[model samples]
Target chain A: MDYHWDWLFFFRETDDGLKYYDWILSGLGWTTLVSLASLALALALGSALGVMRTTPKRWLVAIGDAYVDVFRNIPLIVQLFMWFFVVPELVPDRLGMWMKQDLPYVVIAVVGLGLYTAARIAEQVKAGINSLSRGQRNAGLALGLTEWQTYRHVRLPMAYRIVLPAMTSEAMNIFKNSAVTYAVGILELYFQYKQIIEKTSQVLEITIVVTLAYFALAFLMNRLLAFIERRTRVPGLIVGGKGSN
Target chain B: MSDFDFSVILENWGFLAQGLRYTVQVTITAMLGGILIGTVLALMRLSSLPPLQWFAAGYVNIFRSVPLVQVILAFYLILPMVLQMITGKQMPIGAANSAYFTFTVFEAAYYSEIMRSGIQSVPRGQVAAGYAMGFTYGQTMRLVVLPQAFRNMLPVLLTQTIILFQDVSLVYAIGATDFFGAADKITQRDLRPVEMYTTVAVVYFVICFTLSRLVKLLQSRIAIIR
Candidate 1:
């Protein structure tokens, strides 16, 4: 019924000649890499989808809606499995072979996570754009600006600022969701924790450390976003304030 | 591409149905437990006591910061040890049972945030009005404020539940036989990864998509009432 706790197991070396801590550190690196790369993709694709969703064209809006609905409905793990196992087969033979044999798990994870998260971010961006006054769009048109120019200049900047808070949560979510990559055998932080625990049988200590690592990452992201929100606060433009009227 | 086999899914329909049943069961149990615990946490966060506020805040932040899969794995590994320590005997918490407990605790963090916002959306006058009617603090919350808050946040709560339903798949990390886990096992045994995964994806999509549309309709109806 008793257990021996080893707090120093992280300093020990594995059969692969790397210190246990080094493996964990590499896992952290992969997690960060996956999150950053996916975040970049999500933002670009999501912004485009969001704009499409809010457009006057019916077909474009339908396409955007379908994208969001499909991606958002399916769970991340299922999507990851689809990307890893099914997508390679669906492509051309040479490319499929490359994906199965040569493509890195990191790239697959990035594409899967990025596309899924883009659906969520697209919703946020759509809401942000919708929150702006209709007059803002009309005023841009009155200034003899083209529709594209009005969206580029008048709509997107304010919409981005307005959505910063929502985006903050999404960013944190992406980091947490990166752990799903572990299911596909990616050597991320969660995977490393599992590896260390399995090898050393020091489950509690490793769990605490891994939990702290995730907490620190999320806390840092929260603080960073809050700072940005403060810096970007518009004079008379407030978000979610009580009794602003 | 033209030679897709739909017969495999039909053959395994019973197994898949059982798995879906387990998935829905876990989702419902976790949703109920989460909302129950979340309401208490919400009240704790809103309470005037600093310790309560800190405890609630820490609980919410820790759960939100960590991934659910990690949490599930940790619980699956750690629960047995904790149980043994308490009872001075080995007590193995099976994967299915552990999934229920872990999902409830993990989801409470999210539900608490939603409940907190729901509580805040209530007008301050409602509380004063409750007091004006000669009600105590608990009476005020239990009777007036909570009912209205629940109504106001129903759509959001339902939307979060839809997410919780999807998240039940992650219990596969612990080898729990939820819907996704069942599919994974079949794929491994039958070597039909394409069909198994596609069917799983379509099932999840149909269920989630329908629920989301319902939530949207509810949201519009709520908006109109307001």
Candidate 2:
């Protein structure tokens, strides 16, 4: 075999190493920002929909169900493309032009990632809320709390705690799915790697770096979530056990 | 705009049909290949030896952590170069086929984890009974454990298949002319992105919705068996 290892090329400036490194770092920064923003959006939207899904009002339940079903059924990439390319055109001319020109790519990334992941997150949040004992809600009602106040004071915290694991997985998924932004010309880590490989033809080295970088970042995110889980764990509930892995 | 334009679809029927065939082929190939590799990885993960478990963990982690598109792109670009160096022969097919192979491999990683969970969900008593009845460990796994595990895992396996079907569209990035690529091509050619994509989306919805119902039916049947 005549395969020559070029591991050194990744580190040496003579091979445009600095430029590649900078590109990758910036990509990682955007990826992190997009993931965090989307995580927040998904949590907020998914929670509201999830709560509304359990509402006694028929219309509210219908709306929540429709939101979940429509978004969940569609593929994320298709949705991203539609939002980035098509949605703007449907807006008023001035607003549409401004969105096409001035809207940051990260904003599109957040919307795409947030809405796509929200479907799954909604399911998780609903599961968490449903898993709580019925008596808990009743007790809140008995204490003179309104339906909304009962949920706010009693159900939400417990549901959030119970669903931590699933939420972590969902967040991880959103982070990974952010890679789809590359299709819309966002220079995230995966896109950066693609550009570098195409330019330098150092395919293996660039791929290795990209893969390692993604794995490390994902691992760190998992650990961070795990830490939060540990810190916020209910005292009498399930304690440290084997990871879902 | 015309409420319906049958002629545009009729004109592009050949391309769309070809894309559908490729999409179905990729989904089936990935499903079968993923299940086989996934079964092996699940067994390895469940093995008594620490090294085997660790190796399986590493494999799953690497594939699961990285984005599927990156994997496809890597295999498309790097596989041929490495193959050339080793075999002194060019890979006959270009980047697109390699991307399909990558999708299959990546799907295997996720499928293995799902299978492992299914295997672990099997009651330990079944394996013990198999051993008591003179079955070896492998026989216990194959005859006793796996059958039940598979039944338990049917729903998840079906979900994975649906996801894999959707992921077949990613081959578009590497120029494989699958369903999404065909839609994209039509959009570019006809300058009607909305109509083309809407058609494609409906096609995806029909397939996915039907598969999900099938999954529900399988789950009910499995419940009856239990």
Kept native contacts, fraction for each prediction: 0.83, 0.46
Error of 2 at B89 (Å): 1.1
Can you list each candidate's DockQ?
Answer: 0.80, 0.57
TM-score of 1: 0.97
For all candidates in order, the CA lDDT equals: 0.91, 0.81
Error of 1 at B217 (Å): 1.8
Best by TM-score: 1
Weakest 10 consecutive residues of candidate 1 chain B by summed lDDT: B1-10
lDDT of 2 by residue, B10-129 (tens): 788789889988888888888889988998999999999999999889999888888888887778877887788778898766855775688778888989998999999988888889
lDDT string for model 1 (B20-52, tens) is 999999999999999999999999999999999
Specify the poorest-scoring 10-residue window by lDDT in model 2 chain A: A8-17
